[model samples]
Target: MASPRDPSKRTPEIESWMNGADKLERLLDRDKFKAWGFVIYRCTYRSDSEWEEFIVRIHKRVEEYLGYYNGLDLVGSFAPTVLEDRSFEGATVISLREKFNEWAVTAIKEEQGIDPSHLWHLKNGRYRFFIMVDQEALDSVLSTPEDDIHEGFVRLVNAEWKPEELDEEELAERGGPGPEEEPLEGCTEEDVGWMKVCWGHSQMPGYLQLDGSFDWDMYYSRPPVIQSLS
Candidate 1:
């Protein structure tokens, strides 16, 4: 057998970029990735264009090279959010964790750094961050393969009526049902009709918190729109 190699050969410089322990994904426990099916990337960028470019490029990379296995999508979180003239001010976002492909994310980051004249080198720690999910909430949703789907549907149908209205109707149908009986407890009747429109609608609960991240500025600015993927 060959002699064992010395640990001295492992350079933090090479490992930092290649292995990307400097990358937040390296710091994450592997189970986090497997469980969540995604990760959050929180970073700061100086210019509005930098933010735009990062979002566009990440979307491009996923569309061109990634697939369902990655389950990748993005949100521009906390944008138009800036400190008073900090060198870099960027938003956080959620997407496929780097475990899906080290190079997919690292390559985009590296490419951005290749032409330093265009931008300043940013410390991943100073700029990038991770947002841990509510393990309990995530577990509740994902562990049980079923969703509150029927609950959501019932909510949609009875949104116009008061809670007591549904209760009264049910009691009349069931002949003055006992007070202990409760239908759809812990859930309210509301506008859940959108839930039936798409599978994503069911997942809205997990993602609803991300509504704050929606780039309303994109609509106001009116960038050229794409009618179709083709």
Candidate 2:
């Protein structure tokens, strides 16, 4: 069996995933964009068709926002009987760009083990991602102390967003936003960590949060290209 972290298993799929992350990292390092981040949409669908529909709709919605986005990446899983309880996840990376570029489709999965230092695991089968772009929001969140738990981060990550109001009858019947609009919850401060947000840096490699436990590597060496970002 191929160990999850084995670097020798460099399949095309794995290479694609690495390239995706690297591309995003390079974009961030350029410091050309004002702000960039990702949003985690924790949703479930009744059928594969429904999931496909949602993906198509979202892809279109993202296109409509081209005036405001430089590039975006959509990734996650689709399953029948998707539930709000916990079984599926998805995220959209929106890099508010000054110039437009072709959007990339690259997905991350637990099996990839892309980052050997920190393994990705589905904790309690649930987690959330937050995209804080507002200047004030960025300042507040990025201010979180290194060792301190980020209550602000948790609150924002698990926060629910209500849609434009509907008629009383429509609202009551639909029970408010459907499964796709459900708010993320049950995540605590202990379940999250801010990754690569170094002090005094404006644009740096950023992740939603460290998704899993660590595999501390004392002698690990980053490639020369990656080290240049420091």
Candidate 3:
């Protein structure tokens, strides 16, 4: 499979960001690619610095998996916008609460068909971020069946939305079929089929925890833009 774009080959815009140490700007050149979707999330009760740490960790984790999957790119920002208050709080909380309520009610109705509580207790913290994912990669992962996907690849695409552990042991145990119970007709012991047995874990990106409410806009098609960051 083709590798990710080399940093050495980055465009002039990326070069500028690098020169200025604008990490997010360097990774997310929205004007150059169509967004497959957008994500908004907040951090669990913690300091702003902690939230930034989460962003860095998540970025590194995603980078590791990029080689395992194609068509994926990401860029994120924590800057406050008009929708967000000075503390970077209002917008994300409102949207997450709204979306969570809708989801909870729908789930409850599907199971018991009853009115569900619309309240979502806000967690303590003021860290919020917005991410835009390129369309080609997001669509490919979303349309594929879960059973047919590589665990590591799936984890990369959903890193922010559903933060999952990408451990090799967590993947279904793989091995040749168990020993045959009976011999085929006219087959002797010498005719028994032989199969190789393989074992052990493959390295996987580590786990991450955002620990806050969030929402996904899988159909976002506009050119990537985080107004505040811009």
Candidate 4:
């Protein structure tokens, strides 16, 4: 029998490729004025260390490319191998889905002051994690220390310390806004409002039609080239 793969040993290149595809999906959604396809990057990491490094690197790169993005979020899970289990794997797709759902519920509660009993729908081999963050909530969260934000999240879920600690480090590594940083420019207030509306509507199942099925081939296929925004 083949040895189980160690998700931590996966190269950063693979994670980068997956996240690049996610960014493409988001860009396409914005370009087409669509209400769907807001691109949530998902991956399985072998260890907490690997996951921490991956999150930090992605956040730094994203900040360099786009001053600051309130929409960006991450969730991960860590599972250890059991003794005498030769076929044990560190993480599974199901565990990741659970972690994401946990995060989504907490986020929704914190932002909306209401428990999210029906916040996610997992079907068609994909999990949907949804949250509503209007401008006010976004500004408030961004102003606070990233660690505090993460701690509040952990308190909401009553989860163990492992994932909570990982999330804290990930948020800290993202750093705070730079001195020269300014809110998103170019887009008018009306545009921002529209984007929020689109995001909200898209979270409802069947409300928006995604162009293609959520299959590996469809997701990893070459994306069309677009003119550079830079």
Error of 1 at 54 (Å): 26
Can you write out model 1's per-residue Cα lDDT over 1-230, one digit (the tens) per residue? 44333211223323333321122232223212211111223233334554454334333433332222222232222121112223112311111122213422443245333333321222221112122222222233233323232211100011111233457778788788444422232323332111111112212222221111121111111111111110
Q: Candidate 1 at 122: error in angstroms?
A: 15
lDDT of 4: 0.28
In candidate 1, list every pair of residues with a backbone clash: none
Q: Over the stretch 73-168, how does candidate 2's per-residue lDDT look in tens digits?
A: 322221111123233323211221100111111112232222322212232112223322222323333355433222112112221111245688
Off by over 4 Å in 4: 1-52, 68-89, 111-230
Q: Record all residue pairs in model 3 with backbone atoms less than 3 Å apart, i.e. clashing.
A: 71-137
lDDT of 3 at 93: 29
Give one digit per residue, the lDDT tens place, for model 4 in 1-230.
Answer: 44434311223323322343234334334433212222232232234454344334323434332222222331111111111221223323234345555655664455334446633322211124222222332333334454332211100111111221236566568684223312222221211111122111222111122222242222221111111111
lDDT of the candidates, in the order given: 0.25, 0.28, 0.27, 0.28
